[model samples]
Target: MDLPRTFTIRESEHRIHNPFDERKLADLGAALHLKPGMRMLDLASGSGEMLCSWARDHRLTGTGVDVSTAFTAKARARAAELDVAEQVSFVHGDASGYVSSEPVDVAACIGATWIGGGVAGTIELLRRSLRPGGLMLIGEPFWRKTPPDRETVTACHMGSRDDLFALPGLVAHFGRIGYDQVEMVLADQDSWDRYAAAQWLNTRRWLDQNPEDELAAQMRAELTAAPLQHILYQREYLGWGVFVLMAR
Candidate 1:
């Protein structure tokens, strides 16, 4: 099956789905100190950029699992584009409860923690695929500054202010899970804009091209409305980070 058409279309258009840029992701790869032939397991691996890039940069091997058929296809194409097809594989499947048949050096679930419900459960799921002393990478959101109202909180995808931890609280949550926070890279507002605003432009362009398509109308409506919603509610309140965790 495919992800919702909106998301599928976004992926196919090569829009950034997370608030991370190429430089930031490269910095994360450096922090990991990836070595040749290391194996990585990536859950909810959208477009498989992380795994595919890791394979190319570090000479590693890996498998990425995602539920989106469209994303999986794009991941395969990306692997080929990077000339790393032989080093990485993508599976179209649910990442929830997914465990590697063999332990991996790194297990990651970036920006898709729902695959394991939340940070704690996601870590446990990733740990099952990681060797002792191996690392887990979790990309999650936090409150940059406490939002002033329920509307702002909801736009940031939290039920209430308490639903989102501050950055320090997020680190402490990892500590409670028996993993030490080794390294982290955060997304600034610019990065967030790149991720969120780019999609609106893409959707707008698609609407122009496919005026008669059933989904085009919805996409056009979203394109018209999303920018205001994001700027008003999300840009100021939410923060995102990718943290590396190691068993303590």
Candidate 2:
């Protein structure tokens, strides 16, 4: 009913919990031309930022489900903070195989497709709750370029080069799967910096406060190495984007 403590600790203060900045997120919502009262179902909806923000900005109604109890609570607090609590709800549970009780105008699983094993399986899970002609959103990583070696691939936190497609291949993948890629918003290097670099600071601050905690040693080791690893590998080799899809 919750994420691993280490995962929560690493992203303790992240609101969006992905590479997307607030502006990019807002732009995505606007690009969808979401209407008032549209219903959205968000699976693996970390911190519920997408649902809560869209509910406030677009006047949409949504439900978000996540396995992280801490993140789920943060999401509910975020909804209330945005004064959109009445428009959105968050559930703390597994997102895999989750289908909205009512068909929804949009179904999404952002940055957590592993919940359903991968992009294709996650899309199938999301489609179960989507109304015909409705949209689906998937946020995922791609290879910016083919890594030169297995070491580079491992440094980028992927098991193999096959773990992610290049940008063009990713688009082609959607087409092959009987979905049209209607819209996409990509994260620039700056967005990646914001998402990754912020964790160092969060980890450092936590370490300073919880020096005696059992996880402190691991956090310290990560803080010592993550920035260099990210700058050298992830920033150069990985690209991330949120794509909007429609069933063909």
Candidate 3:
């Protein structure tokens, strides 16, 4: 199983595949005070940046599972490039319902919580693979500002504003779910721009190379409209962050 070709095409260059930069990721690794030899399990682990980087820098070991064959290959290449191929590995498989064979020091479902249906279900999924006192990392979106109406919510690709909690509400949710939020690194508008805006360029470059490809027209339309849509809706109303949690 794999992600849609469109997704791979658009995010082909993204190491993290979410609205996060290297600095933010480094900040997260640092904040965790990761000691060498810790184990992590990252579900929906796009391109394996976090795992590979942490493996190299923190001397952590991890397995990353992803649904994208293309991204899985990239992740493996990244691990090799970082000289941490022995420490981290990527599996090309569905992350949904994936429980680790062994409990890990960290269990994560970053950005693609749909693997477990939603945030709460995803947390439950992650918990199954976490060792006692281990951390769970969730990367999710919250309402940066409550959308004024349905149109804005739709523009942000949300079914309804109710689908997302505000920042404070989301943190409160962790407590309600038997976890305490101990650390977080949030994405600002600039990171959103880096994530979404870069897709436009990737689409454009792809279109230039294969104007007659089956998906070219769709990509062209997206390239034309995505910038304005991102600026108008996503960059303003949606906030994203990776939160670190431990069971209470």
Instruction: Give the Cα error of residue 230 in candidate 3, in Å.
Output: 1.0
> Count of backbone clashes for each model?
0, 0, 0
Please report, in order, the local distance difference test score of every candidate based on alpha carbons. Answer: 0.87, 0.94, 0.93
Give per-residue lDDT, candidate 1, residue 112. Answer: 89
- Each prediction's Cα RMSD? 1.4, 0.7, 0.8
Q: What TM-scores do the predictions have?
A: 0.95, 0.98, 0.98
Q: Candidates ranked by lDDT, best first?
A: 2, 3, 1
Question: Candidate 2: which pairs clash?
Answer: none
Task: Give the distance in Å from residue 89's predicted Cα in candidate 1 to where it truly belongs.
Answer: 0.4
lDDT of 2 by residue, 67-92 (tens): 99999999999999999999999999
Q: What is the lDDT of candidate 3?
A: 0.93
**Best by the lDDT measure:** 2
For residue 178, model 1's alpha carbon misses the true position, in angstroms, by 1.1
* Better by lDDT, candidate 2 or 1: 2
